[model samples]
Target chain A: MTEAVAIENLSVTFTGGSKPVRAVDGVSLSLGQGEVLALLGESGSGKSVTLRSLLRLHPPKRSRMTGSIRVAGRDVLELSPGELADFRGGVVSMIFQEPMLALDPVYTVGAQITEAIRRHEKISAADARKRALALFERVRIPSPDRRLDAYPHEMSGGMRQRAMIALALACRPSVLLADEPTTALDATVQIQILLLLRELQRELGLSIIFVTHDIGVAVEIADRIAVMYAGRVVESGSVRDVIRGPRHPYTRGLLASRVERAQKGDRLETIPGSPPDLTALPPGCAFAPRCSLAAPQCREIVPPLAEVGPAHTAACIRVAETV
Target chain B: MIIGEPAHLPDGPDRGGPAQPLLSVRDLVKHFPVKGKGLFGKGAVVRAVDGVSFDIRKGETLGVVGESGCGKSTTARLLMHLIKADSGEMVFDGEKVGADLDLTAYRRQVQMVFQDSYASLNPRLTIEESIAYGPQVHGVSAAKARAKAHDLLARVGLEPGRFAGRYPHELSGGQRQRINIARALALEPRLVILDEAVSALDKSVEAQVLNLLQDLKDEFGLTYVFISHDLNVVKFIVDRVMVMYLGKVAEIGEGPAVFGAPRHPYTAALLASMPKMDPDARSAEAPLTGDPPNPINPPSGCRFHTRCALAEPVCSVQEPPLAAMEGLQEAACLMALPGSGHSRAPAPVEAAA
Candidate 1:
């Protein structure tokens, strides 16, 4: 299978007057065609920064990014301003967390979708309108003809999300980077959006990099999962392996802390302490202070991503001995 | 599921003690006039909180679950009297509460933790000053208020010495929420309304905050009206659960009864739609069709009848009242009503394709 997207040693730093904040440390990841990969993390875990880096969407004036980001056989960093704009909506499309903000309030849904189509393809207005309606139908938007005339503010949260998805898929991009696409939606709508994404991925053979803070959502959609913390991928594996039996303490803590399995009276197992500050991360393992099973070796040296089993890896010093 | 588990009822007035309920709401209705003006000039009313009634026992958590615009948040605001109800009776501790009731005294006893912590907290005020504001308004000495603020910060898991002087922008989302929680507790309010308190947080951070809430509930003997859009979180924290749709209570029951065996079709659909953390337990039911109806002229019968799959002709004509079921369970659906012919054989309607 061809690699749909490959990122190598990507690092993002926000430089100010004195000390620069490393928002994302050196990290490498790859996605195959039709593959769904979930980047799971808490706030400030650098998942959003990594996703923003894919299309050079980060603030360039303050953000300093290094390393190669290859999407659809093209180096994303090497593209010129005009080339980047053409590449953005054409090769790699993105659906943001808040659809209302991503969508133009003044423009009708049809107009936006048609603009997306017209930007990439030199089609007439009539042809673009037809394609927009078709895309709306593909996303299962009810009464596509009527919804095309509705503005973003006129639509419900779920409808707005569907429209956003329609816009992202409008240009038939090879890779879709969804940053918490369903976070603000209700549970039912979240499921609908997830199922739609999964269906579209199957039909279109588009690679997806899904970023979320909810593990349940990742389990429902992702083929592979990457658990990030501070600024690095702490663990990466197939969804089944990572969910069923996680090796990293952060992953284990996340699984154990989830309110999913507990009965009404069951006390939730909470991971004590908070996420480490990016500006002042601790020495060695960033999770050492909160890890219950932390050993002396964990505080002295940063662990490499050690493979525990086929397609399963964890960046922990005790990964070999823990399981 | 355990049947007739009294432990499910938190330490409230209705749980056999002589003390009265801390808050009792009857037929609560809050309607906000729609934005636009017309010849009828009054404009259509957004039935943010329709005819809903429930009681919050002292020192108990009453979880209200619904989607956005389902009136859960409106119900919270109504209980706090932050927004007045159009038509309803709010009785607190055996005393009938009116709009003219001295809000200052009531404000001291009722505190609210909002969803957007940053928006709720004053950017100009330091953490200590923010928390102290409530106590100061209640006529406490400046020294005492500052002391209470420090105590509240520690109670909500923030270090007072380190965080007291910091501004809202300096803290993380979770830390800001903790400050919000601390500010709510500053006055030692009897009832706390947590409106989607942990929804904006990461799952891990949410869990920690939930644990903190449970601890505080036990230690302070606090009564909570926990409102949220997430059912899974509600299931984990609440003792009794109320399912709302279109500004009405669709179902009300003990946590296990409501979650394990939902009576109303709307409740069943909502339960089915929730994604199970366990990958093997996925449901095959299609997601509910159509958005909730407009609240201005809500469906004639049951507010949910428009979207309800099992809604019959009667559901579109006669509004079903919230009535009790077999055990600690209540649903306001014609199908769940007694002598409705549909309740005779529960399995038939539920089991049929």
Candidate 2:
């Protein structure tokens, strides 16, 4: 299978803070063409940082990035200003968690989408606008034509997200990075957005990297799952394999704690401690403090991703014997 | 009228008259006026909560679930009397809240925990001070309140020695929430309203807090009005579930009944909308379409008709009243009633039989 996107030993350090925070540490991930990968983690998990890195969305002076990012045959780190501009929307585009903040407040949603399309391709204004309307319709925004003229503030939360998705897909990019796209939405509306994204990913043959803290959402859309803890992908495999039989202790703890897994009135299984601070991370595994199966070795040395099953890997020494 | 829970109602029936509910709310309404677009134009009212009513039995956690603008949070606020209702009657422990129960006294017995833990706490005040502030205002001596704060802090799993001197900014999200829970219990309130309290925490932390909450409830014999949007959490924690849509109660009953066999179309759609744990059983289509109609001018008759899949012409013509179904649950749906003019409804004779 062709690799649509790849990252080798990517590490992002935000130097602007009191201490240089290693937001993402030694993370390597790859995405196949027309596949969906869910990067699952809580806040400060570096899931968002990794996704933003794909677009070089971070400020260069404030943050130092050491990695090789290759997407659609272009080295992302090597792209010129002009090339990066085109590559952002033409090769890969992103939709954020809050559309209200992500979208420009002054411009109409239709105008922004049209501008995106026209910038990527040498299309006429009329043609670009027609395409924008089609994209809105494709995303199932009710009254597409009327809504196209509406400003970002005029739409509801769910509608704004739909508009955001339409804008992201304006240039027909091969990759779509969604960061908690449906987290702000209602359950009913959240399901709608998830289904819409899944449908669009299939129809467009788009390789999507969806980041969310909600495990159920990850299960709903991703063909593959990568569970991140304190900037590292602790476990990854096919969604079926990972959800059904998670090897990493953290993954096991997360799946077990879900309210869906237990009967009413039963106490939910909980991970004992909290996520580590990135700035002053422990010497070894970041999740060691929270992990139930952590041993002396776990706190002494960082665990590398090791194969446990076919196309499955876990970053824990304790899991080796069990696997 | 109190909606009694016949099956799961508390043990030991009253020796006197019929047992009174812990809290009974009737026809609660609250509307906020929206200024007109033009200065001279007529104003509009946002129907935040319209004629919502329910009963909170003793020693029970009643869960309210809904999307945004469904009036769940507003109902929580109204229950706490944080925001005065435009028109409603609230009865607490058989005494009318305003008529018999003094508002100040009532405030001491009911407390609320908001979603934003940090904002809820005073940054300038220490953890012990925050927790002790409540009791101090209610006439507890400073020394006694501080001692009680330490006790409550220990109960919430935060060591008083380590956490009492810390401010809100010094704690993590989970830790801060625990502090908030401790502060809520500082008043030794009978009823605690948790409005999206655990919604902000991480899944792992959320589970820990949930467990802590259950333990606290058992220890204090506290009743809770747990409001949240997460259906799975609500289903697991709440003894009774209330499903709301567009400022109206769509369904309310025993937790399992409401979740497993919903009587209202909106309730059924909501249950269907929850993302399943099993990846193989993903929902093929969205159960409901379109955002809920603007609350300022909700859909006529049935507010949910615009988004409800099973809505009929009668749904737009006449509103369905919340009434007991043939089964254990109570639903506000035309079809749930045999003679409610819905095509799919069972015949009156069949239902009667």
TM-score of chain A of 2: 0.98
- C-alpha local distance difference test of each model: 0.85, 0.90
Best by DockQ: 2
Candidate 1 runs further than 4 Å off: A16-18, B1-19, B37-42, B99-101, B281-285, B341-353
- Of all native A–B interface contacts, model 1 reproduces a fraction of 0.56
Q: What value does the lDDT take at residue A289 in candidate 2?
A: 88
- For model 1 chain B, where is the 10-residue window of minimal lDDT? B1-10
lDDT tens digits, residue span B1-353, model 2 = 12221211232322122467778999999998888673324677889999999999888999999889999999999999999999989988877898887787677778999999999999999999999998787767788889999999999999999999999998899999999999998877888999999999999999999999999999988889999999889999999989988888989999988888998888888888888878899889999887777788888887777877788899998888887865568998888767779897767866452
Instruction: Please report the candidate that would top TM-score against the real structure.
Output: 2
Every model's DockQ, to 2 decimals? 0.58, 0.82
Could you report the Cα RMSD, in angstroms, for every candidate shown?
Answer: 5.7, 4.3
In model 1, pairs of residues that clash are: none
| Deviation from truth (RMSD, Å), model 1 | 5.7
Candidate 2 chain B: worst-modelled 10 consecutive residues by lDDT: B1-10
Give the Å shift of residue B84 in candidate 1. Answer: 1.2
State candidate 1's DockQ.
0.58
